[model samples]
Target: MRTAVCSGSFDPITLGHLDIIRRTAACFEQVWVCVSPNAEKKNQMFTPEQKLLLVKAAVAEYPNVRAELWPGLLADYAMDHGACAIVRGVRNATDWDVERELARINADLHPGLDTMLLPAAAEYEHFSSSMVREMIRYGQPLEKYLPAAAVELVRKMRTELNREEA
Candidate 1:
């Protein structure tokens, strides 16, 4: 089977992330949506476990897609899973530059693994996890930003956060 690994710190899986996963699923027989941590990011709204749950919910519609929590190096995960490629979503030039460098690093780590960059669809080009978090903080509706399956969970999480702050 041609497997692809899509790794991200999906604190709360957004529609844009889903879009990339859906596209990747179409190209690969098996796709792993790995919810890994970003060491540089702090004050995360959702824990890794929560992120895993959200990712699971967001990707439930894709029969060939599975969500996993991988704390180690992405290259290691890809290697262990027998992935042929690492799929990444590029929304703009900045994303391209960053993903390109990361792809180079991954190639260094796993010579056999290739990185596939998919440009975001027009509707989802502006969607980002950070932006979704900001919207959650301000009590903005998330129906449009998050996948239908994940919106309720995010709302519940938002309520819990509100209760904690009160």
Candidate 2:
């Protein structure tokens, strides 16, 4: 089977992330939506477990797509999962540059691993998890940028965040 690993922090799974996951699922026999933790990233809005739950809910319709929590290097995760390629979503120039470099690094880490960059759908080109977190922090509606199943979880997290700050 041609398996692909799509790993990301997924602090909150936006529609943009779901778009990439769905496209990857269509292209590969199986796609693993990995919710990875970034020790360098200190601005996380959700826990890894929360992120995993959100991913599971978002990808429930795609039988071939499975969500996992990966704690090691992405290349290692891909190798462990028997993935032939890594699927990345590029939304703009910045994403392209970063992902391209990361892909190169992944290739270096695992000689035969391929990286596929999937462009974001035009409608979701402007959406991102960080932006959604900002919206939630300031009380903005998220229905348009996230799947219906995820909206509630985001709202609940936002409320908890508000309480924490209070």
**Tens-place lDDT digits, model 1, residues 1-166:** 9999998999788899999999999999999999999999887889899899999998988999998999999999999999999999999999999999999999999898999999999999999899999998888988999999999998887788779999
Report the lDDT tens digits of candidate 2 across residue range 1-166.
Answer: 9999998998889999999999999989999888999998778989999899989999999999999998899999999999999999999999999999999999999999999998999999998888988887788888888888888887887778779999
Q: List runs of model 2 lying over 4 Å from the truth.
A: 160-166
Q: What shift in Å separates residue 76 of candidate 1 from its native position after superposition?
A: 0.5
Candidate 2 local distance difference test against the native: 0.91
| Model 1: residues with Cα > 4 Å off, grouped in runs | none
lDDT of 1: 0.92
Clash counts per candidate, in order, are: 0, 0
Candidate 2 differs from the real structure by a C-alpha RMSD in angstroms, to one decimal, of: 1.5
Native-to-model Cα distance after best TM-score fit, residue 24 in candidate 2, in Å:
0.6
